[model samples]
Target: MNNRFKAVLFGVLLVYGLMLSASFILALFVRFDWISTQSLDWLPFLISLTIMLLGGGLSGFRSSEKGWLSGVLVGVIYTVMIMLYQFLAHDVWLHDGQWLHFITFLLASISGGIIGVQLNQRND
Candidate 1:
């Protein structure tokens, strides 16, 4: 209910929403045969970065100095959600596609954390 908590929640929700959208769009493209669905994991990576930006921007707007943690937290949440969704939809684990999400999430978290930290310090 406080500003800090609100900002963190907002960032996580924003990233999760964007990541879901990206996954859905990727599914569409794959279904249409426009692109190889096998590479759909790329969607999460790119979208995660976008979400990181959103998270960083929100944290910056809130004038909070907790950018890196917020970004990393958001990334981790998004990754967990994505993995859950994948499991529910495919009912499978240990697939190539699954690994993509895992790897991308890891990278996104690091990059997003750094970005968030930098952004938090920008106006200081």
Candidate 2:
């Protein structure tokens, strides 16, 4: 696959994987409300970092010009996935805290994409 395609796929899968894992962890610890973090706060940041580093490393097609687009794409895809899940599960719901979740996700995705592209260029 071309590097751009690989970069896009990596961004999508990395964000998806991290989000799902974070959701699972939240569900697992919902009863205790561990550290008062029942909301999905950490997921987006973590996913963005993972995707930025891993995706760039793997694809080796990083460019500052594409960072914004890539980041936005990842954020949009992740949000849509979350929305779909909320739709599918009748009991599942996003509280007001979810606003923070989406915001963080967008910020993290954008930052990560920028950093990734910068690193890729530097390395080259």
The candidate maximizing TM-score is: 2
Worst 10 residues of 1 by lDDT: 55-64
The TM-score values for the models, in the order shown, are 0.59, 0.63
- Using lDDT, give the best candidate's number: 1
In model 2, the runs with Cα more than 4 Å from the true position are: 1-5, 21-64, 91-93
Candidate 1 Cα outliers beyond 4 Å, as residue runs: 38-44, 60-63, 79-107, 110-124
Instruction: Please write out the lDDT profile of model 1 over residues 1-124, one tens digit for every residue.
Output: 7765676677666766776787788778888999885776555556656666675456435536555565556666666776787689888646666676566565555455566557666767
Error of 2 at 121 (Å): 0.4
Q: Single out the weakest 10-residue window by summed lDDT for candidate 2.
A: 55-64
lDDT by candidate, in order shown = 0.63, 0.63
